[model samples]
Target: MKRTEAEQFTRRLTHHGEGPVWLGHHGLAVLDMLAGDVVLIDDSGAETRREHLGAVVAALRPRRDGGFVAGLERGFCLLNDRFTVTETVTCWTSPDVRMNEGACDPQGRFWCGSMAYDLTPGAGALWHLDPTGAAVQAIAGIGCSNGLAWTRDGTRGYYVDSLTGRVDILELRPDGAIANRRPFVDVTGEGFPDGIAVDQADGVWLAMFGSGLLLHFDRTGRRDAEIAVPVRQVTACTFAGPDYSELYITTSRYGLTDPEAAAGAVFRARPDVGGFAPYAFSG
Candidate 1:
């Protein structure tokens, strides 16, 4: 496999940096997850703004109409273009679990998974929120639910329940429901899979937490390339730049007593292929 190193894009900016989304001219948006902050960075790797939503901001995706849809600590919220919270919905009353990671489908539906704060097994679930402001439990019995991505066509989805140590493939129905699911990649001994992004060429770039590496898997699940990051807690990644050729990565300083200077910093790499823009939530 071809190997490369990602260059540091900025100084350590987050304690537990996660979800990364590339917004064309608007630059990049990432989360200081545990801090409940939405961080906006310019194309030049400069932090331009930071907006706190609640006790935790797990994930976020742009909206088709405008603004954004985000997964908060125990529920979901909508934000206007100005980063102001417009509405909020509590999915459940359970205070033990929190939203973790998610992505919007091509059909404008936002899907996010949850996990227990203490990492309790099977204490979380996958949720679906349609454009009409309706929330439904898509899947239950999940543990450490993380990384989610869908194919451009919306027919397939790649998901990670980190505790499984594998990435699973989901057969998505026309209505944004999962028709079937099966294992797609087994990273059993490599490291824990955290976040993922799919390229236009059907390549899945997965961030391996604690391994300091990003593994690229082709359409057939064959390892093709590797991007080495400076921090061990590599969290998430996304395609950015005008043409979406730039791969932006996020790292974390969580659970580290003495982390590297670059921990919690963002990094960038030039992959062979670009990626599609993030699917916006129709609502």
Candidate 2:
């Protein structure tokens, strides 16, 4: 498939912009992980406000009752409409490790992963955080856990552990349980996979950090298409717009001697394929 193109959408550049999420009433949001800022972008793709969480904010998802549930440094936090940290849970007591990436399951549970500052081989773990403030360890013994997505049926989950260079499939049970881990896609190459999103057609749009490409893989784990961004540190992406056909992406300028104008700017593209509306965090 031919590569799709995207244009810069935001004026603000992040030092390490990572996760991009679409909230209808809130517009779009992207995080400068290390800077602890949740930057909101308007529908016109303009930077609106910068909400500081004081610690590394890896990812975030909307709460069912409004507000948001976020993956913060070493734990999880609840943010209100004012973007203030209301309730906090310290899942990891270690100062060296911080939240990395995550998303909500179909059951409305927030699942987040963590990694060490030095990127230790097995210092990261994945957890299932309940809205009731329960953080349960789901999977561990991994490295750089990132990019999570689920199938339309909610029976299968896809995940990426950058260290493994493969995307794994998880068995998602109706009772909100995950099991039967197996490799789904082997993206062995120069760069590790960063973030991912799923569309209505079960196509997985994954951001490849070093490759500067967002790969689209079908349910069968075949690379069907790809989108090219102007930056080399593309991080995460999600479907936005009313029909969820617009792909909002995030990138970083963590390590670049000379970067382009779009290095840490948010980008958007109309892939011609609609995306799935993400499940809200019930807890």
Candidate 3:
């Protein structure tokens, strides 16, 4: 497939912008991971407001309760309508570890992985927290756990451990857990893969940071298409347009110089195929 170029959608800058998600009327919400902020942006790309959690807001999803389930610096949080921390559950105690990218399964169980601030190899692991509040270790020995997306039918899951240089797939057991881990596709990019999304056709669109591209992988794990952006730090991507044909990408200006004007802006693109609407956290 030919490489598609993206256009700037919004001009909001993020030190480490990540985790873009669409919640219909909610417009778009993204994490300024290092800034410990979750900012809401309208369709016009205006920053509506931001919630400062005093801790890194790594990833989050809308909850059936009308709030959100989120991964924070040292634990998971349940926020109410006012964006107040109604509940906070600590996973591990060390400040060295921080939450990374995460997404909810069809059953409403939220899964997010963690990594060391120093990026210590094998110092991170993926964790699953169900609505019942039972947290389990899904995968161990990971470095820089970055992205997680599930298939439409919820039988399979995809993950990116940026350090591994490949996207991995796991069989989602009936219990809303994962197993049988294996490599899905190997990738060569400038800064490894970041966040990812699955289309209605199960096509995987991955953000390749430092490479200024979003690479597309088909169900068979073959590189089929790619998108070129203006900046090197393409952090994450999601589908949120009218018919879900518009792909929204999040980027960062962290450690960047002579950067493209749109480096920290949200970029928009139209793919031939639309995407699957993500399920909210039913918990």
Top-lDDT structure, candidate number: 1
Cα lDDT of all candidates, in order? 0.92, 0.86, 0.86
**Per-residue error (Å), model 2, residue 114:** 0.6
Q: TM-score for each prediction?
A: 0.98, 0.96, 0.96
Poorly placed runs, candidate 3 (over 4 Å): none
Q: What's the residue-level lDDT of 119 in candidate 2?
A: 91
lDDT of 1 at 181: 91
Q: Give the clashing pairs for model 3.
A: none
Candidate 3 — worst ten consecutive residues by lDDT sum?
185-194
Task: Give the TM-score ranking, best first.
Answer: 1, 2, 3
lDDT of 1 by residue, 1-283 (tens): 8999999998888999999997655679889999999998997789998999989998999998788999998878999988899999899888899999999988888899999999999999999889999998989999999999988777689999999999999887887778999999999989999999999977799999999999999989999999999889998999887788899999999989999999999999999988988999999
Clashing pairs in 2: 131-283
User: Which window of 10 residues has the lowest lDDT sum in candidate 1?
Assistant: 21-30
lDDT of 3 at 5: 97
